[model samples]
Target: MGKKETIRKKSPPPTNQPVKDVYPTPPPLPVKAPNNGRKNGSTTTGNNCASTTTKDLWDDLFDGGYRADVTIKTDNGDIIYAHANVLGMASPVLRGMLKRAKGCGEKKPISIHGVHQDAVRVFIRFLYSSCYENEEMKEFVVPLLVLSHAYNVPRLKRVVEVELEHGLLNTENVVDIFQLSLLCNAPRLTLISHRMILKNFKAVVATKGWSSMRNSHPGLEKELLESVIEEENNQKEKIRKSKEQKIYLELFEAMEALVHICRDGCRTIGPHDKDFTQNQAPCKYRACKGLELLVRHFAGCKLRVPGGCIHCKRMWRLLELHSRLCADSKVCRVPLCRNFKEKIRKQSKKDEIKWKLLVKKILRTKRIRGSVSFLVSSNSISS
Candidate 1:
């Protein structure tokens, strides 16, 4: 009876009761993540964590919103940018320079704003840590030279000058380096370099003479010699036309005086002169002796027999003797004869004008003889 009463009391559940679906809600539609791809307040948490993880990294990289360390990566390699602080530097200017340097990558990997990689690296290291010294400076010498010229780095240029001074003193590299010094407009460097170059005058004259001749045009050569002469002449000239004319006259007089002095001192002495002793004073009285000595001492000039006239009796005597001794010998064949003959031929050619005139006279005589022979043969045929 109690169970039946409980059943009667349990009426139908309320028709408007909420139904519980088996499928769960779709996670609030994922909140459609923000365009920044971050959850709200997530970055704040991350920022805090990152700051804690790497303290002072940003501070070290940037000072008061200005970056001091510039990172540059190129195809060749990585380069760090730095500069010297002579005085207070402007942040904007520094930033501009950095930007310009970075923009240089458009043309090539190793160039920054037309500055070469070697130069840029040297400049960067110099600016950043002042690390160039001794051996390191030597490694950077060539690049620094280019950089110094490009950027007008006076101090760096001086360093290059010092290196060149040391290098030019070497006998092996003197001539080429002297030319380079002159081309670069280093006057002091040229003086040292010239000394080295002049040490090998004969070698330079024999091997490099053509190039030197080409470099000095007729006008320039004349002007140079004239200037030397003018320097020797200290006499004042009458002012007939202008100061320029007087200067010219003075220069001419100086040049004449110099020539006279040179002729008296150098040209008068013979090879067998009493004062001319190779051991005592080899170059004392010879015109070309000084040049020869200079060339041999520094330029490693080969010892060659002195050239002489082929038509001279001495030369003919030597040839006759050689021919008599070696004519029938197979060992002294075409090559050996040709070598000796060539020496004679070159000596003959030294007086090319005289040889040519002699040859022409012989040809004319031969033509006259040929005509006379023809006439005699005609008369004989007729008889």
Candidate 2:
């Protein structure tokens, strides 16, 4: 009747309990990376005193600071100022001026004479900056150079000379530059000018500067002509030596090839073929340079032919060339030529006579050597 119709009072529908709500976690915000271009060693602040350890400190320190100690008065009445330590470091003359001047405590301004105000300013700036302004300032280089020599500034003088030599070097101005170089005692520049004048001697002589120098500088023109003559002689000597060397190399190659053919011979070109006695076969190896002409001349060369074959003549010439090229003849490979050398030394024979004697001796030696080889072969065959 209710199987316990007492539905237990239905348990109040199990007291409807509230369920907790769930939410998804938001994706982590994308993390930003720092820029790579930030200088790692650099640190800075708005206040100048807070910065430290910069990459090139002297530039910023010498640029425009609150620590300048003295003023410079130039010949043109322009005034500039700089620190005493910088001036002292730049020139011994400046150091001495500071040391000797009295009645002042680092406030005295030094007066510079014989130099343009613009040049003096550039000089002082170079002392601090190690280099001056733009190309517009090139006009001041000569005046700066003069100032550098007067003040014993070697580094600045060298820089000025390089600028003049490279940047200002032209036919129109080279003579002036050369004169300035000579006056400044610049040896490298003087030598360079001398060579330049020699190279364009005609054009240089036609210039107004050369006309002025001719009236003033005497030994220089003579020196230039002598240098030109010496150069011509040197070139002639070089050409002669080069020709001699080329002929010598050709002779050596020909001798080596001839010896090879005389001995065992080659597969392509050997003495067994009658081609050795023919003079008209163009070579396939060394272009059309008469390389095959000597083979016919060497096959049956005779020592008693009253003169000699082309091969014997070349061999004789080779010996003579060896005597000339060799620095020391005491230990020469051409022992017979060494005796020939002694004979010539003793009797002082003419070159033509000595050459004929050399040819004869070479032919005689070939005959003797051939006979000895033939006799040896015959004896061996009989045994």
Candidate 3:
């Protein structure tokens, strides 16, 4: 019998397995954080890197020596290995993506496009441990914000927003930052950027970002223009109201001075019964001296009749205002107080409305000026 030939079935060549790409261990990035004030022997390397005794383990795991379950494919085609558990726990968005990938038969590398790979690397490091470099933050803050928003990482988003607002927000970048803030849904940053743009509108308009925004986002440009015009109108309105308020306050002070002169005597003028001694001290009211001079002029001026002299007309208007505000016109010491009240009552509807509005304004101004106590006492004296 011929020796039975043993046909050895060669085992299938070893299944070709692609080599996993490993990123070099990045030095710990220095994160800006308040110091504990206690001296520690551990050297600070990079932002958020473990500075404690177990730092080596953290570095090994993050630098890809330990078991990394998922790979991140950056826009530049760099492969970064990461642990699914850490990323999933940090972000629900990432958890869902990881789950979706696992559910599929093939685990394709998660692609993060439209950003620099270094920014992606920094982002992944933050997921593993919360830390980052200051210079990198300055250079890649906007990209980080975009990534944070896309990945639904609120903490990183807030950090980037704060860094931009505090350090980078300026006339040069305000317009650009404002647009990004809206896209990222960062309200505080939006408000700050809006205010900065408004405050330096001319400078902001001159920036390249503003020009680009105007061309690309005509709606935003129109909205900002409307806001600026509205802000200008508001400022002008405030100024006009301020001037009107001053006039009303002056009228109120004049009324008080008139009452003081009629009821009690000022330094030079008063009712017939009150003493006008030359040695009396000056009145406390600010308008006393001025009103005393006006009364002296009205008494002596040959054109004392109505519609005659401007000074007399001014005095007549003052007396009319006093009559409108007076509680008791019958026995009021002010000359023509009753006669003015009678004329006011017989005034045309237009004149009546005009005087009433003036009276209302004076009273409102008095209340706002905190002179209620003084007016109350004056009313009591009249009664």
Candidate 4:
């Protein structure tokens, strides 16, 4: 004994039918015209009720009843009824087809292939009414996108792209959608799908769709791999720039602290006029306390030669920077400021350019930090 095949009923001529078909590849059945016995161009509601809005009129037209002028045949021979003018106005590609078919005095059925009949029904529904059920959209979005693209329906294409970008896109189907986006020339969808692939590379590459695409489309596979590498390199570059920015910001803060200490001093270090023995309140500058310790170290370190000690070399560099930045180098309280100014004149052109570049970076960093107030005014370099 064999199980009997289920014969599903066709969609009735009505407004807003629930989209519940499971899209099984049912065997082709005999085609029959809908039996709504009404004359063409008549949309009488029979109850004498008025349609309150344009949407209601469009809905009535989409219901087709007996007014549809043409039929659309789907991949599995399921027939959908629609108006010629509606389809013509909504899509230029369809208009062209309809124009070429004008010689056939009677309208012939327009055949749409490569997708399920249920999807074709939804596509036709949207063309007439600019409306669709959520369930139908969820089930037939990809097919709808393809139909929209093929038929040159930009509005429907845009809507489908948004739907895919916001809700339908996932790692399991992203690779397929990415390829579709390229085929359809949807730049936004392409960008979004590409980002999803890059962000979830392992999961996306593991999907069956990606596996199929890899086997059949080696060029695309190579392109995606190159993009992944480029994305990684871009991330590395961002990290490097962030680290460099941090160093420049620190140097900027250190420069500010150096000027503050030289002019007003911290709790334990200052010029001849400033007191060094008073138990002053904690320094307001965040870097001042650290710079005070380094100053004390620089004053007492025995290995103060150019290459002798790292700490002294750091102090020497700071002092040299201050000299380059100071307008009144001769009277600047910072030790070696005058000496560095004199010695800078004898430096090689390469060394001078390097120091000038460093100085520019520090000044640029300071300018970027517009909120930081200066602590000293005398002889500071004009930026």
How far does residue 294 in candidate 1 sit from its true spot (Å)? 40
Question: How high is the lDDT of residue 35 in model 2?
Answer: 28
Candidates sorted by TM-score, best first: 4, 3, 2, 1
Per-prediction backbone clash count: 2, 1, 8, 0
Q: Which stretches of candidate 1 lie over 4 Å from their true place?
A: 1-78, 83-120, 128-131, 167-176, 202-383
TM-score of each: 0.29, 0.54, 0.76, 0.77
The local lDDT score (0 to 100) that residue 359 gets in candidate 1 is 32
- Model 1 Cα shift for residue 99 (angstroms): 6.7
Residue 11 of model 3 has an lDDT of 71
Q: Which candidate do you rate higher for TM-score, 2 or 3? A: 3
lDDT of 2 at 231: 81
lDDT of 1 by residue, 1-383 (tens): 36554345666557686554434566555342222221111213323343311323332323232433444443356554333131014223344444555334332112344445655555544432223445545555555655555544555556577766766245444544455455566688768755544455445435453256447645533543464455345333334334654443333233222222223333333223224334543333232444333323322324323344322333333332332223232443211344553454465545545543433343344444443211112221111
Question: Per-residue lDDT tens digits of candidate 3, residues 287-326?
Answer: 8888889999999999999899999999999998887777
List candidate 4 segments past 4 Å from native: 1-57, 100-107, 276-282, 371-383
Name the candidate that leads on lDDT. 3
lDDT of each: 0.41, 0.59, 0.79, 0.77
